[model samples]
Target: MKQISTILFSTVFFPLLQPVWDKEPFNISNISKPDAPFFLEDAGIKEQGAYFRQLPDPRIKSRIALSLLKTNNEKAVEILENMLRDEKNDNVISDLFICMYRLRDKAKITYSERIKKYMEHQDQLIRGYAAALYFIKTSDAATILTMLEKENSLFVQELLWNELASKPKSCNQEDLKKFLQSKDSIRRAGAVRVLALASKEPDSVPKLKKAAEDELPVRIALAKALKEMPDAGNELIAKLAEDKSSIVRALVASCAVSDKRLKTLVKLSGDKDWEVRRAACETLGGSKSPEAISALLARMNDNYEPVRTAAEDALVKINPGEDTIKKLTEFVKSDAHRDAAIRVLGMLGAKNSALDILNVLNGKAEDETVRRAVEALGRLECKSAADAIASKSSSKNPAVRKAVAFTIGRLGVASTFKTLELLTKDKDASVVLEAINAMGLIADKSFNKRLNEIVKDVKPSTSSDMRAYACWAVSRINAPTDGMMEEMKKLFLKKIIPMEGEKTYDADYARAAAIMALVEMGGKKNEPSMKAAKSAISFFHENPFKTKDEDSITLKEYMRQIQAVMNGTEIKPELVPTVKPELVTGKVQ
Candidate 1:
């Protein structure tokens, strides 16, 4: 049990530090999305016309959403539509779909086959805009159901169901009730959300009772729908909390709490399934009741790290400032949960706990516990702990050495680069890599000549974590000489494939780093290699194979600007596009 928990704890990435170049580690719930359609504030005909003239290509419709606000949207519709017909960039096409959708009323368009075609586009963002435009213009329930049959993205699904509820004349309640019994699961689940959304109290409540016996997805949908309806009553939430599937109980555990519901949540906090207990902890993070604190603090020693983390977040929220500090301070001094408490105090930026952790570092704690203390001090940004942390660099355990390297870099002082440079030559490969990467965070140019040699030594496309971060680290050192650009053109531009045992996510990030370096080095005029590299990146942004974060395409638009610059055509920042706010998908899962 202890071994399993230790491995699980190592895998956890806290909602912690964010480097400007990196997006949060990818999770479906927090995927980076395309920019919403932007309308420059107070845009008028002159502003639109003036801004329009400056675009490198007025046909790239994404850049001028606000600039086009004053142009007769009717005439503008024809121009934007023609431009998108041959467009290839998904982000660009997404911007086009939104631009055309914005002009729908002025163009007097119908819910025609063309709109349906756009709805079926491969891009999630594009499909969402098409669905929204469809929802606004069509009054046919069959049309809504047809789209629903083919779509399953929670973000898009939530949009369709909620719109179905508002447009009473568009779809009758009978159509949704019939779908509840449909053989297709998406239809069955959609029906639950739609019915619950349009719930007419006592009458609608009876229609949903049979859903308890439906398939798991449908039941899960039913539970989520109730979350939005606070007046739906704790009895309903309490019933779902007793669900046979831990997933259903977890979803129900998140519903807004009432006095009666709090008792149910507290009971669930001790649930047999750790996930159910975790969900209960997360849901009750907002409560101030003493019971909530007691249940959460008890979870601090949980076998699963995430459960303990969820509890830590709950305690911090309920007892912020000195109250939380006082609770956690005692937790660190105790023999129980020593590693977790030490790291969490750092995560919470407990300045008062800094000396306590430093004391642990100097003690005869276990190696793993010593490692945690180093990481905790790093998170706390304890510059004063520098000498003390560096003293652990020669520990026989490589893991301890790795943590020492990480914390030293997080200290972010130029003086520490000499220390990091020494670790870069460590016997252990991982320690060396961590040291090299850590040096990137510090703003010193003195190491570039040697760091550039490391970039030169890499075998292209191997996708070594060191290779990925070496590319990342090199960009920060700012050596944009022509000689380096020549090497990047010959090497870094090759498709950086994941090494046999390496993660694809790191390889994908390596691709971003190489392009960022080249963009700074300045692209050669009309270089086919550069253009091909740009196309590859656009697809990465459009359809990341296994890459999780949207930031995998962070350099897409900026690269576009660089390409334009290489061609001697300058573009304005105002023309960069974003998705329309109302058009962004939401609220499904």
Candidate 2:
């Protein structure tokens, strides 16, 4: 019974031990090298090497064959070669032959011969992999692909098609030419990529143009391909700008931006899709064509910020002259415009007339009025009002002082910057803090060192404001820092706002300043803060103070400031739609 058990165990387990035995006694140094057709009878090699061998089930055989190829073992090839004789396993053998083709370090004659057998394989996968191997492993120009004519599977055909398209030296140009005009879109599309890559054959452009009319993806791919050729497909890319697909239109716009194709892209600016409009704006900006300015300006009313911003940006890029400046200047004053006007004017660099326009800011002086004026002046470098602005610095009014300091800095001149420095030393802490902020705005490269010096000298009482403004100025003048953003929000949320405080102009100014700061920051982070600003705006608009004049509220200046920040419009709560003339005449609400 023991002997029978031993024999049974040996039969199953002896093959597994063969590799160990072979390693011990099979020293190749003294023995002659084994010839081909060697078989690894070891159970481990038999199981693993079967991957390269042809088997009845090609799927299982292919998976295993891939593993054997990875081992790069010489005996695996012998096992694969023997499997090729079985007709049922021809698919597996074809795959193994392709693997053998890849064994060569170079695309030499040996590799091409091994890959050539796949052209006769009945299976499309075998034929596809074979074609891939031939194109990738060998550079023989005469291997004009003849198998693509017989390919049946769309996927395998795509692979073969790409091989022909990409490998110019080895591609069958005549076959590819015929395929470019094939009734099948896929084949024709593949041919386009192949031919366009090979040569911008003028004759091929007509086929691509025809294909683009019916196919969207191929049109875009062809557009991109044509963009690279010398005037290669400029007309085609321009024509694609009118494509029904917004994605295609956007790509064409992008291409237009790169190629300075303003004429065609301008027509796309009115695309029904906002995305296309935005892309058109971006393209116009790059084109820098004067004709695009009006189109971009028209798009400024787009509901989307990206579109509006792009349009405004494009206007500045194309025609940043008197017309664009006038529109921006008027927009900064328009209640209907978005807060982006501040950026528009800043980009305009029209700071010279910043203070001059303050005289026109007499429209119910809301904090928005003062804030936008301040930002515009800061952008324009209107530093002439240093003394007048400084005198109001300590007028026992935080709003007036904040506005004055903001304006002084917005003027962007070092002369007014000194007044800000003096205000930082005022007995009133907020006054002193606002002064430090003014220094930040006048980020005249000449005062960078001085600003740094004063930033360090800020007292502990207002270091938070100083640090906040210091970082803000640095962001405005240099690069943005995470600290600046957080501190700005903190100051706006806590110190720079009056959520439900007394109706003092200072309280109003503080709230308005907070709104302006948040708007200037310009991102989703300000969503909650903007909601607060809206509330404050509504609060003031509903309750009017007693005024000597009947035509407008007594606090026109304050109203104007608020209105400016609220985009020059007030959202008066319906409860008190308009300030009654009798209310400001001392009659109770």
**Per-residue lDDT of candidate 2, residues 1-589 (tens digit):** 0122111101211011112212221111212112212122334345555433323455766666555444323444445444454435665666665665555332222345555775666777666666666666565434534555556678677776656655654555665678765566666666666666666553345666675686765665565555445445566767777777887777766654544466777878888888888887887886555677767767766778789888777765665777667776676555555345555665577664454455534334455445545555555665564454455554455666666676676555555566676665666766655665555455454444544543343234544344434434433344223343344334333333233653112222232233344443333345544454455446444536523442222124434543554463443321111110110011112
Per-residue lDDT over 51-121 for candidate 1, one digit per residue giving the tens place of the 0 to 100 score: 44344453433565533543432545545555555556677677767776667666634434566677777
RMSD in angstroms between candidate 2 and the native structure over all alpha carbons: 26.9
Candidate 2 global TM-score: 0.44
On lDDT, the leading prediction is 1
lDDT (C-alpha) at residue 105 in model 1: 61
TM-score of decoy 1:
0.52
